[model samples]
Target: MRLANRVRELRARFRLSQHELAEQIEVSRQTIALIERGDYSPSVVIALKMAQLFKEPVEMIFYLEEEQQ
Candidate 1:
C-alpha cells in the first residue's frame, strides 16, 4: 500500500499556499510539496501538526491506498 493524503485539498480549502501551510506546520515548502505529491511520508509529529492545523483527524488527512499492480 502507498500512503496518500488530502493535504492539497485541505490546504486549498483553508486558502493556504504550500509555503503558508509549511510555515504553520514548521516544515519547508519542499516538504509540503513532497507530501502532497505522495513522494514522501511525513513523520508522526508532522502529521499531527497538520491534523491540528486542518482541524481534522490524522486518519482523515492520510491513509493507505492499495498500489495498483
Candidate 2:
C-alpha cells in the first residue's frame, strides 16, 4: 500500500505556507515538503496534529491506496 495526502491542498485552503504548517505541527519545513511530495509518511502523532490543524478527518488527509494485483 502507498500513502497519499491532500496536505498541499488543505494548506492552501487555510492560507498557510509550508513553513507555517511545519511550525504549527512542530516539524521542519523539509518534512512538510516531503509529505506534500508523497516522499514521506508522517507518524501518527504528526498526522493527528495536521488533521486537527486542518479541521479535517485523518482519513480525509491521509489514506492508503491498495496496489492493483
Candidate 3:
C-alpha cells in the first residue's frame, strides 16, 4: 500500500502557501513539503488536526493505494 495525500490541491484551493499551511498546522514547512512529496506520513493526531482545520474528511485528504511493489 502507498500512502498519499491531496495536500497540494487543498493548499492551492485554500490559497495557502506551504509556510502558511505549516503555521496553521503547527508544523515546519519542511514537514509539509515532505508530506506533499509523499516522503513522509503524518501521524493520526496531526492528520486529524489537518482535516479539521480544512473542514474535510480524513479520507478525502489522505488515502492508501493498493499496489504491488
lDDT of each: 0.97, 0.95, 0.93
Write candidate 2's Cα lDDT for 1-69 as tens digits: 999999999999999999999999999999999999999999999999998999999999999888679
Error of 1 at 38 (Å): 0.3
Model 2, 58: alpha-carbon shift in Å?
0.4
Q: Pick out the ten consecutive residues of candidate 3 with the lowest summed lDDT.
A: 60-69
- True-structure RMSD, every candidate: 0.5, 1.6, 1.3
Please provide, for model 1 over 1-69, each residue's C-alpha lDDT reduced to its tens digit, 9 standing for 90 to 100.
999999999999999999899899899999999999999999999999999999999999999999999
Decreasing lDDT order of the candidates: 1, 2, 3
Instruction: Tell me model 3's lDDT, rounded to 2 decimals.
Output: 0.93
| TM-score of every prediction relative to native | 0.97, 0.92, 0.92
The runs of at least 3 residues in candidate 2 whose Cα sits more than 4 Å from the true structure, single-residue gaps closed, are 66-69
User: Number of backbone collisions per candidate, in order?
Assistant: 0, 0, 0
Worst 10 residues of 2 by lDDT: 60-69
For 19-64, candidate 3 gives per-residue lDDT tens digits of 9999998999999999999999999987998899889999999999
Which one is best on lDDT? 1
TM-score quality measure for candidate 1: 0.97
